[model samples]
Target: MAVTSNKQGAAMQLCMALPENFRRQDFLAFHRRDADQLSEHVTEDSLLKGVVWQGQPACLSLFFTERNVSVTLDADTAWSADGQRTLEAWVGHMLGLTQPVAHFEQRFAADPVVGSLLQRQAGLRVPQSASAFEAVAWAIIGQQISVSVAIAVRRKLIQHASLLHASGLYCHPDAQTVAGMDEEQLKALGFSRSKAVALLGVARNEELVALLAQPVATAEQAEAVSSRLLAVKGIGPWTVSYALLRGFGWLDGSLHGDVAVRRNLQQLLQRPEKLSDKETAEWLRAFSPWRALMAAHLWAQQSSAGY
Candidate 1:
């Protein structure tokens, strides 16, 4: 087992939520529950460990495989409290795993047809993750980069986002802070023009502010609310879908266009021919909500293949 510590500091009261609609075992299974690669995260300061962000009141969500559940942010340090945290882990789990049709029929409701379809197919789903501010920030840092490289960039971005001490872990930057950052600063940090532009543009978008203003509940409304994010300048189908899975708690979204996903699917399908978008869509359709889980499973496989 790994020791646990918070980089930001001691926390306020943490209200952890794991929705009844979501299954913890199903969710962990999707991520493979692989501790070797995920251990550093037990300490909040590690690059590959937790997901940190600065919203109205600066929050952090860290994943500790040592404990089978993804823990809520311990917001203590300089960060104060809001009212209550909204996890919708159930919704996130819905979007993160791939399951059999029968299994999903039992778990997810039918009001959202696509989500239900996905649930029936995929066992789990990945949540959309962060709001636009955090999504674009992460997306920019991760663009055209390897996992290690992206993790390094995230470290720098987090450093730029706040005043770090104690253990050198910092909160993700606020939109205003990032908005004021110059392209030259980003360039000096090896950020590509496209990535810098996208990140900065996100920092300036008023819609990001609007999103921050809202209370994040779950993916119950993702099928409708996702469109608002998709309309953003830097956001696209993949980005929105990513957010829906991690952020909005989308249960059934898949990223067929993703390079990693495409490569992984190629290995999984082992078809006579290369996969087209249409064919990929068809092939992935069977996985539905579990497509995200399949994705995680495939990612772990691909990642281990190199070793």
Candidate 2:
């Protein structure tokens, strides 16, 4: 085994507020990796193997490949000059940099579970937005299954429909690709009867994206979006919450159906039973718009555990 960081790129300013060109060789077992393929597919022609972290674009260690794995950021347009700089700058922008960083400090300071996970712990990386299609698809795949299997299925989806190189950099598939998938093709790829149907149903529905882009100014706006999202077949509360936090950037809600999360908390408190949705909800209500980050931290704990 070997470690290398010898790639040459432009000398752009790395935001002091974010992570850059980093990868934990042990990250895979730590959080079990995002088996559902959370990398951003922001365009039809490009596949973003990175994510929007603190509004900055960040990627895994893949400097040797030809098809750059960097997400472009900081430019006026969606496209970036270098995937590295663009991704970083853009992610920082999405994180609402204008708001005082103190806002986050204050929020985390007020909550022990979330704040402790951030300040005192390591191994978690949160994204700015979740791919709506990916989250719902993941929720459907993981409805009654183990996290490992769900990740396997998602890996197949990416290999079949996404772009990647031998170097291990993968580009997430956009909704349009999923929306246009032929029925037989997906079935052949292991999409269960119900998940396949539900995935296509939501994919073809243009209204989902339209509504997601609206101004979520009030509780009513958030509630309306949540309700409409849940109405879709194969999409339920856990799925909806994942989408809101990962896709829509509404990070205050906790993911209910994640087996790993239940396990982590159970292990932490030495609880007698797995957490029920009601208990999970009560626990998360205090986070108020940062549940996504909270979830990320829990997942990271599992990651660091060598699970």
Cα RMSDs, all models: 7.7, 8.4
Can you give the TM-score per candidate against the true fold?
0.61, 0.64
Question: Which lDDT tens digits does candidate 2 get at residues 68-162?
Answer: 23322221223335545444433433332222224554667656455665665532434433345555666666667776777777777776765
Q: Candidate 1: where is the Cα deviation over 4 Å? A: 1-10, 14-132, 165-167, 212-235, 286-294, 300-307
* lDDT of every model, 2 decimals: 0.49, 0.53
Lowest-sum lDDT 10-residue window in model 1: 38-47
Give the C-alpha miss distance for residue 285 in model 1, angstroms.
3.8
Off by over 4 Å in 2: 1-90, 93-118, 122-125, 128-130, 162-170, 212-221, 304-307
lDDT of 2: 0.53
Per-residue CA lDDT of candidate 1, range 1-307, in tens?
1122233345432323333344433433332323333212323221122334343333344342322334445444354333222333322333332223346545444534344434543433243333545654665566556756766665566656554423343445667878889888877676777677767766677775566435344455554445665555555666655554444443456766667777766766565666776766676677665555445444544552110
Please tell me which predicted candidate would have the highest TM-score against the true structure.
2
